[model samples]
Target chain A: MELLVASAIGVIMAAGVYLLLRARTLPVVLGLTLVTYAVNLFLFVTGRLTVDQAPVLNQGHESFADPLPQALVLTAIVISFGMTAVIVVMALKSYVESDSDHVDLDPQDDGEADS
Target chain B: MNHWIILPLLLPALVAPLIALAVRHDIVLQRIFSVSSTVILLVLGAILMGSTASDPVQSYHLGNWIAPFGIVLVLDRLSAMLLVLTAGLGLAVLLYAINGWDAEGRHFHPLFQFQLMGINGAFLTGDLFNLFVFFEVLLIASYGLMVHAGGAARMKAGVQYVTINLVGSGLFLIGVGLIYSVTGTLNMAHLATEVGRVDAADRALLEIGGLLLLLVFAVKAALVPVQFWLPGTYANAPPPVAALFAIMTKVGAYAIIRVYTLIFGDDAGASANLAGPWLLPAALVTMVIGMAGVLAARRLGEAVAFAVIGSMGTLLAAVSVFTQEAMAAALYYLLHSTIAGGALFLIVDLVNQRRTGYTDWLRAAPPFVHTGFIAALFLLGAMAMTGMPPLSGFIGKLLVLDGVRESSYAVWIWGLILGTSLLAIVGFARAGTTVFWKSAAVGGYLEPARPLAPALPFVAVGILLGASIVLTAFAGPVTVYLDTVAEQIYNPSGYIETVLPTSGHPEGVRP
Candidate 1:
């Protein structure tokens, strides 16, 4: 189980990095989403992998899984969701305004400089 | 249990939503409420600073819950000082914005309030995850403000800024997770004690987590190798928004000081001073590159952006020494640079608003109506930024230099700082001559196509510059207070004791 989770995180992060390096805005947005997924998974695993164990106290049970990481991961998920939404809208706005999807602004297109 | 400790965070949080919901369409009402709240915040901040001066540390636990379990807001000399600075800057920027900058976009008042809430929260929170939450709050609000005046340049800069910060936030979460997995606590006070007790086998993981966290802060601080996003973002932002952002980099510096000394100080076993060796060299390189950017900048706003970067490098280099005196100097420099950098941004906008052609570009264009007054303001701002005498910048640099004189890197520090000051002076001189002096020499001066900017904005900038002068005039008492703040930071026992009274067993320890 541990090996599976680690490999999954690695694969997701690799994909995220590859997409993040792309010059297009949409790919970059997608890349951030992928990286956030990896991060959320990593945060979840911080409580350690436990099967059939309650996060809450159970009578007659010697141990239960730590619950703090679960709460943290949940909060992180919601925050990342909001962030992803904001970035997507921003990318769309930039694309519509500039008529280009490339992430870097062309020097000539800088309005203040040209003005 | 002081309830007032949470006021800084609460006032803005509550006021923001009220402005968004209740007075969204009423610009007059929004302005009235926003300005009043900011004034109240400044007064509260002053009171907090005065109270914390003698007491040194105060903690407020949420909902009567104990430390390490419930959310905690800890106010010390450091947080109080920053709170007051933020409120002062926010008021100045908000007042300036009311001169029609807020009308450029929707929800300006609410977003401004939200940004303040995030900044205050980040400064006051005692937990790592809470800090992350506040960072998101600020970043989101900043995204709205950056593109508030919606132009192609702003949208492009906003996209890049958001993407880079998202990645940094990811790293922050991973680092916090790893630390929590090992130490089982996110409360900074508890982490301070628990980090020292980590087992030898887990020390490597702990170090990796700590360094990763530092990397996160380095990105925020615009430290070298991770600072590419700052110039574009700052230059593209609206002047008033950019002025508020002058404190944002200092937030990163504040976090570095707070976390490094509290949790990863000289006593954190193998993680002791993990960032110490690398910080100074990186800071020097940051200084050199930032000054280079300033010299190469083609526009006045871009030059101010690079100057901000340069100031950060200087401040961080002093902090890297990790001595109490050096920390005091760093704090003093931090306060001075924020005000000066903020004033410079506002002055650039004022210049941009007045020019008939090639606005804000470092070229010989026709002079505006208030050329002499604007020129003098720019000169004083530039002098302060470049560390000239009779301004706070010189005093800050002297204090930092004096503090680091005993360190092994003293020679390098002195050399780089002095050389950079010379470069900054030359850059500002060239810019000033091109923009102001040579412009008057141009024949056939044309009347400005636009009316002159209101005197209110100039008054706002003057207030900021006046504050810097006051900082210089009161350098003795201010430095003494910062000395005590630095002392409290270096010795975290008082902080920990206030946050967590029981040392051996924290309140929220899970069996």
Candidate 2:
């Protein structure tokens, strides 16, 4: 279970990074979404993987998954969702203003010299 | 549990919603609420600072829940001081914004208030996860403000800024998760107690987690290798928003000081001074690169932005030592740099507003009305930024240099800080001369597109510069206060006990 979760997280994060490096804003937004997903999963498993266990303490339950990470994941999900919405709107706005989808302000002058 | 500790967060949170909902369409009403709330915040902050002066660390657990189980807001001399600074800066920037900058966009007042709430929350939160939440709050508010008066350039820069910060947010969560997994606690006070007892096997994970967190703070602080986003964002952001952002980077610095000194300081058995080794070198490099950028900038606003980065480098170098004297000096430098950087941004805006054709560009232009007064303000701002005598910047640098003199890296610290000051002086001089002095040879006065008073902006600039002068004049008492602040920072027993008065371990949960 740990291997499955950890590998899934690694693969998702790698894909996120790849998408993040793309020159278009949509891909970057998608990349951020993917990264957030991976983070949520990573946070979910931080309490150690447990199946068929209550997240909170119960008299009948001898084992329980840590509930704090679950709460943390919930908050992370909400924030990431809101942020994704914000970025999408911003990207669309930038596209309309510059009339270009490429992330750089001037695609022709894309170099490290000026920045 | 002094209720005042929570007011800094509550007042802005409540006022922001009121402005957004009740007065969304009324700029006048929005400004009135925003400005009044900020004034109250400043007063509240001063009260908190005074309270902490007598009683250092005070923690307020939400819902009266015990520590480690519930979210907590820890108020200390550090948080109180930052709260006051944020409110003061917010008020000045709010005034300058209402002077006409707010009209450029809708919802400026709400967003400004929300930004203040986030900053104050970040300063006051005692839990790592809560800090992340506040960071998001601020970043979200800043995004709205960043592109508030949107142009093509500003919007594009805004997109880039949002992307980088999203990536940073991901890293932040990963760091917090790693730390939580090992320590089984996210409360900073609880983590401080737990960090030392981690198994030998888990120490590496904890260290990696700590360093990852450092990277996140470094990104926010605009430390080297992660500072690429600052110049573009600051230059493109509306001057008033950029001025408020002067406190944002300091948020990162504040977090570094808080987390490192309290959680990973000398008491942590295996991870003692976890950030010390990496911080100094990166800080020195940050100084060099920032000054070089200042020298190379083609626009006045961009130059000031780079100067901010340089100042952060200087401030962090002092903090890297972790000694009370050095931390005191770092706090003073932090206060000085925020005011100076904020003033310079405002001054650049004034210059931009006046120039006929080239707004804030470094080339000579036709003279404008009030050139002498605006130029004089710019000169004083530049002097403070470049650490010239008779201003707070000079005193800040001297304190930093003297504080770090006993360290092994003294030679490097001395050499880099001194060299960078020279670089900054030259850079500011060249920009000032081209903008103010060389413009005298140009043909005509820059006629106004509209009749302008610019009284509020000048007043705003004057208030900030006056604060800098006050910092210089009262350096003695200020340093004495900062000495206690630093002393409280290094000795976290007071903080830890206040946050978690019972068992060192959190009793309610298990991992």
For all candidates, state DockQ relative to the true structure: 0.65, 0.49
Residue range B208-301, candidate 2, lDDT tens digits: 9999999999999999989999999999999989999999999999999999999999999999999999999999999999998899988988
Candidate 2 runs further than 4 Å off = A59-62, A107-115, B503-508
TM-score of chain B of each: 0.98, 0.99
Query: Looking at model 2, how many pairs of residues clash?
Result: 0
The candidate 2 chain B region of ten consecutive residues with least summed lDDT is B502-511
User: Fraction of native Cα contacts kept in each candidate?
Assistant: 0.78, 0.69
lDDT of 2 by residue, A4-112 (tens): 8899999999999999999999999999999999999999889888888886888888788788898999999999999999999999999999999889867322111
lDDT (10s digit) by residue, model 1, range B65-135: 88888899999999999999999999999988998889889999999999999999999999999999999
Assess the local accuracy of residue A84 in candidate 2 as a C-alpha lDDT between 0 and 100: 96
Say which candidate scores most in lDDT.
Answer: 2
